[model samples]
Target: MVTVKMLKPYYIKADDNYVRVILAYQYFAVFINNKVYQFVPIESKEIRINRRTKKVENLGARFAFQKGKDIIYMAMSELISLPDFLVQLHSIADPYYLNKEIKSEPNYESEAIIDELEQLNMKRLIDKALDNRDYEAFQSLVKLL
Candidate 1:
């Protein structure tokens, strides 16, 4: 039985398409048959997950794990079967999604301020047009109002 022992990401980079979890040496570990195996990235150290679906998009071609100099190469498929692994991965990735949501949400206070400013500028322009007796400009500005 394989169980996730530790799955700490060095950093998480998220964008519209993907969330990349970069792992460093000893950052990821698992228990296989009561033995601890620490993952060592071979080809790539990053795991790419779909931002929308939250599903893993890429795991390097192969990975190496070490247990006191006894190194073993394993395919990512082996790890995907463990429910605990997915649970932990999602938990770690959830915070990045939350942060993205917080950032993407509209800032109502700032938006309100900007709208007020634009309205004030428009009113000032209309007043100026009226004072100058520019009927065409006044009519256009009033229409905008």
Candidate 2:
């Protein structure tokens, strides 16, 4: 039976020899398990209805990235608290060219290429995101396309 679980957001320091999986929004390093998997965003739109008020309201988007055949789905919102090194690398800082510096670092180039190819079909990906009610993802696709 396939097991599902949430992966706490973790960062692998520069000295670590783990595989880094880069995505459009964020990146992660799988240190313990050298596993092949894909993360599928679960719902993009989260609607909540008050029982007493009987009114439906849009809650901030709730999403989880379902991982691999094991089917673990980690909530993206829960990961929001984690620092995004990629973003931070590109952002203004004393080491103004940190982004460029990190480019030379060890990245799973093959996996990165695979991710790019998977996302090559912008229209199809956008359609899927739309179907999931993920407007943010849809907008990102628009910019990418």
Candidate 3:
């Protein structure tokens, strides 16, 4: 049986001779050395693997790949990463008024928008963040929660 390892380093040699690294909860596997080498974190929308110089590249979401026996899968790099409290906080944005002249430049009524939105509208913001691999955003939202 093919053991489905959770949250561990997984290396697979594609038929094209490239190694792909499977990351936990990530959509695409990292490719390198004409073979997938290692997979990055789930929120890394795009991770570049350079065989010649060992460089990292970024590609926001828009990912695609094939699994064993020719099963294709797709997912975005951006996805909500906020914790419980932050998620709840971000959901209620319309109720309050965001002032742009008070503190920061793009001052929102409340950064809580991100956290609460992700939690309530789980389908929209949360999914979007993961698809784009925006874990940093998720982290910020989490703190607020």
Every candidate's lDDT: 0.81, 0.41, 0.37
RMSD of 2: 28.1
lDDT of 1 by residue, 49-115 (tens): 8877777877544667789888877665666678987888888888655343444678899999999
Best prediction by TM-score: 1
Residue range with the least summed lDDT across 10 consecutive positions in model 1: 95-104
* lDDT by residue (tens digit), candidate 3, 1-145: 1111222223322222222333443432433223432223424333233333322223244333334334332333231221431232223221232333456476475667876676676555655777799998766655544
- Runs off by more than 4 Å, candidate 1: 98-145
| Model 2 CA lDDT for position 79 | 34
Q: Each model's TM-score, in the order given?
A: 0.63, 0.23, 0.19
lDDT of 2 by residue, 34-136 (tens): 4433334445422223323322233354444433446444343433333452233223122221232334556698889978887777779999999999999
lDDT of 2: 0.41
Q: Between the candidate structures 1 and 2, which one is better when assessed by TM-score?
A: 1
- Local distance difference test, candidate 1: 0.81
Show pairs that collide, candidate 1. Answer: none
Cand. 3 Cα-lDDT: 0.37
